[model samples]
Target: MRRIWFALFGGLFGAVGVAFLGAFRADALADPTSLATFSLWLGASTLYVLGGLDASIGDFDWYQLVGLGNVCLGLQMVARAAMTLADGTGETEPLLATFGGVVGGLTLAYIGLDWFRGGRHFDLSTFEESPTADPE
Candidate 1:
């Protein structure tokens, strides 16, 4: 029980910290707005994966696997930010964006393959796509 609490809080805090770090790094990127966009997309994806992991109630499963992959991607972005800062306005955009695009692109490919192979659906969620919403 205590371990569950630790994992829950640890995961929550870890994700939040990573996202916050990304937010703080936005200004250092080649184009702050582009990094902002990346942060936004990554933030949404992080929240979604966290929600799934939370729903699983700390079980070790696919949700955790997805969350782990997300962590990998987030670390890369953070590393890019650090590199950009270190370079101090050198030709960092291409390298940073290329790395992000490659990793994110491959992630999307894996996700698409898994989805087509009957993987988890982010859609059909009772939380998001509630059937009882008032027709507006």
Candidate 2:
């Protein structure tokens, strides 16, 4: 069920990205850095859904991991936005969007770390047995 939602969200993001790219001119899209960053985010989002499902067992408590992925994607988007601003080719809209992206990513990353520290309350037993546990 969660996987479905992740996949759906990723698809939606991809659609928006596609539209954004389509509306832009070819010369802008030709940027290798921009293209690579976008590609990485797309790939990461896709993997998040697929791999998350595979790793989860209805109790995987993956909010932190998912959050991390979200942050990563946001950072990429923000970087692209910053580039757009630097190039001075687009309106201020991209700059604002980039700022928003960076903020969103930072927020997500903070939440993820917080959860990892204590919010999620993951059980230590879930980890494989340590050699010391045997005490042979």
Candidate 3:
């Protein structure tokens, strides 16, 4: 059941993330508004995935994935802000945006594949215990 939820989340948000990243990378729009819009979409996708994972896992340790996604989103936002402020006045490396895009893209691909494949296989264990007599 948990795995199913995870798959659903991955399939949905993963597609959105991939789309936003691809657009940001390939589009020729250089304006701050365009970049901001892309960043917002990426951030939204990140949050959605994180929330879904947390709900499905039900463990604090499972939040690491969410943290990583948030970090990537942060990087994307920071890069966009810096780029907008610079406004071509000074040379600046778009490292944050590029790295975030790469990470998001790779993660989306991995998550989508895993979701489609029905998730990783794990051995299930069953236990039996002696039954007590029923009272009349």
Candidate 4:
């Protein structure tokens, strides 16, 4: 079930990554970076978030990883937003829409994956700590 969720959402993120990366060469997006490096950075970060979410459930919890990923992606979007637009950048509204689209998709996937995985708890604080065996 987890694998299935990963395969589904991972592909979604990957597609969004490609769209954002391709926005540079295409007219579909505004705020296209003049440098290929930025495109790659955004694409790579998107994929990172995707891959991080797709990582198999280890001893550590998955939500913590995904939550941290939300932070990382949030930071990237914020930093990129801080940059002044180059002359003749495309529509700002569309750019924002595009950004929101990707983030929203990732968030939905995150929550959906959690629901599909069976159990849920507020394990945020201790996700990093090793799990202890239940004592009777």
Best by TM-score: 2
**Model 1 Cα lDDT, one tens digit per residue, 12-84:** 6557757765787745455654455455445535544544444453554434444453444455455454555
- Residues 1-136 of candidate 4 have per-residue lDDT tens digits of 2323433554566677677657655543444443433454444454445434555545444554454444444444444444433333688885776567556646644543453342263333332335577897
Cand. 1 TM to true fold: 0.30
Tens-digit lDDT string for candidate 3 (28-115): 3467666665655455455546544545444432233433444444455555555555565443455555556566655644543443
Per-candidate TM-score against the hidden true structure: 0.30, 0.54, 0.33, 0.37
Worst 10 residues of 4 by lDDT: 118-127
Q: Note the Cα lDDT for every prediction shown.
A: 0.49, 0.59, 0.49, 0.48
Candidate 4: count the clashes: 0
Regions more than 4 Å wrong, model 2 = 14-29, 55-65, 89-97, 112-136
lDDT by residue for model 2 over 74-114, one digit each (tens)? 56766766676678755677667777877876675565455
Q: Which candidate is the best by lDDT?
A: 2
CA deviation > 4 Å runs, candidate 4: 1-7, 23-60, 84-136
Spell out the clash pairs found in candidate 4: none
Candidate ranking (TM-score, best to worst): 2, 4, 3, 1
Model 3 residue 32 CA deviation (Å) reads: 15
